[model samples]
Target: MLGGISIWQLLIVLGIIILVFGTKKLRNVGTDLGGAVKGFKKAVHEDEKDTDKPDADQPQSKVSHDEAGNTYDVQAEEKAKQKAENNDERK
Candidate 1:
């Protein structure tokens, strides 16, 4: 038994799922899910490289200004925070 369920029980659940979605649709779903996971992993790897190399010895957030004396760093920080929020929402 595994997790309070027998092997036959697990097989029954799998059978039900296969019956409901059919083999072809399930295969396509699995392929799409795998591709999505691969793409996400690649994106995270690339994002890490970009952030780590650019500010290796400094903080992730920095301060800057424009000709009109408007602060830009805070805007950048807000954008980054919003991006993080979006990622969390996806999860």
Candidate 2:
């Protein structure tokens, strides 16, 4: 028994399906389903690849310059501030 249904019972259900929606229709439906699944998988993989890549148009630098021409790396400045705060706490 397959899934608690006998082989003959399964065959009868298959026959009914074939009779309702002939062989060609069923084949087309199967092909369309497979294509949809393949497209979904391809889209998912493309998204994953996109996320892994950094955008080419955007700047990668942490440094920024002000209108007066002063330049500084924001990340380094933040780290320095945190270190000072930690030192103050230790005291």
The TM-scores of all predictions, comma-separated, are 0.56, 0.55
Task: State in Å the error of residue 72, model 2.
Answer: 41
lDDT of 2 by residue, 1-82 (tens): 6689998998999999999999999999999999999999999999888788778557787875457756678999999999
lDDT of 1 at 89: 100
Please provide, for model 1 over 1-91, each residue's C-alpha lDDT reduced to its tens digit, 9 standing for 90 to 100: 6789999999999999999999999999999999999999999999889877855777567665546755469888999999999999999
Evaluate residue 40 in candidate 2 and report its C-alpha lDDT on the 0 to 100 scale: 100
lDDT value, residue 18 of candidate 1: 99
lDDT for 80 (candidate 1): 99
Native-structure RMSD, model 2: 14.0
Q: Give candidate 2's whole-model lDDT.
A: 0.92
